[model samples]
Target: EDQVTQSPEALRLQEGESSSLNCSYTVSGLRGLFWYRQDPGKGPEFLFTLYSAGEEKEKERLKATLTKKESFLHITAPKPEDSATYLCAVQGVTGFQKLVFGTGTRLLVSP
Candidate 1:
């Protein structure tokens, strides 16, 4: 079976706080791992794409790293503006790319 799981469904952080969010997944054939940020009432915005283990990508206060079975999103000195729901998805190459998304991690950063 193929599934994606994200921990701590929700998180609250004060401005300047830092934390890491986890995404655990199991797929028969992983073509890629994707990270996205979704603001309330809006569609997801692409963040990163991990095509293999040991791959990593970063932008501003966020860093995403992927391993064989898991991925991590690390936030450094987060700000209130950084608050959003982080989504993790896996794509399998089964004739085509099909994305399976995790429930997502809602992060609230208060000033």
Candidate 2:
């Protein structure tokens, strides 16, 4: 079974504070690790896509990296707008085309 799970279900950070969130997974063959930011009552916004281990991508104050067993989302100097549920998903082998997802890490950035 391919699955993704995130830790620290929720996190609080003051503006300008930095932190890292983890997303662990179990799968037969890892295709990709995707990070998305979802605001309350809305759909997820694509963040980053990690294709292999040691590969990293970044935009604005957010950085994402992938490993064999896990991925990390790092926020630097977060702002209130960055306060959103960060979702991690994994694309791997299944019966058909279905993505395994992590519950998500809720990040709260206070101004």
Candidate 3:
């Protein structure tokens, strides 16, 4: 079975503090790794997609990196507005291409 685990469950940061959130996975065959940011009541918002090891994507204060077994979401100098539930999902080489998602990391940035 494909599985995903996100660390720390929750994180607290001060404005301008930087940290990285982890997403570890085990799959039969990796198709893609995805990152998402979700607010309290809204659905997840797509952030990045990594298809192969060593691939990386960046947007504003967030950077996403992928390795063979895990991915990381690096947040640099975060602000209060950057606080959200960060999600990690993976797609394997199955017929349905279903996505296995982690519980997510809740990030709270206080000014």
Give RMSD to native, each candidate: 0.9, 1.1, 0.7
Q: Which stretches of candidate 3 lie over 4 Å from their true place?
A: none
Q: Residue by residue across 52-100, what tens digits does model 3's lDDT show?
A: 9999999999999999999999999999999999999999998477889
True lDDT of residue 72, candidate 3: 94
Model 1 scores worst on lDDT over the 10 consecutive residues at: 91-100
In candidate 2, stretches whose alpha carbon ends up further than 4 angstroms from where it belongs are none
Question: Which candidate gets the maximum TM-score versus the true structure?
Answer: 3
List clashing residue pairs in candidate 1: none
Q: Output the lDDT of residue 75, model 1.
A: 97
Give the per-residue lDDT digits (tens) of candidate 1, residues 5-26.
9998999999999999999999
Q: List the residue pairs that clash in candidate 2.
A: none
Ordered from best to worst lDDT, the candidate numbers read 3, 1, 2
lDDT for every model? 0.94, 0.90, 0.95
Reference-based TM-score, model 2: 0.95
The stretch of ten residues in a row with the least summed lDDT in candidate 3 is 90-99
Return the TM-score for each candidate structure: 0.96, 0.95, 0.97
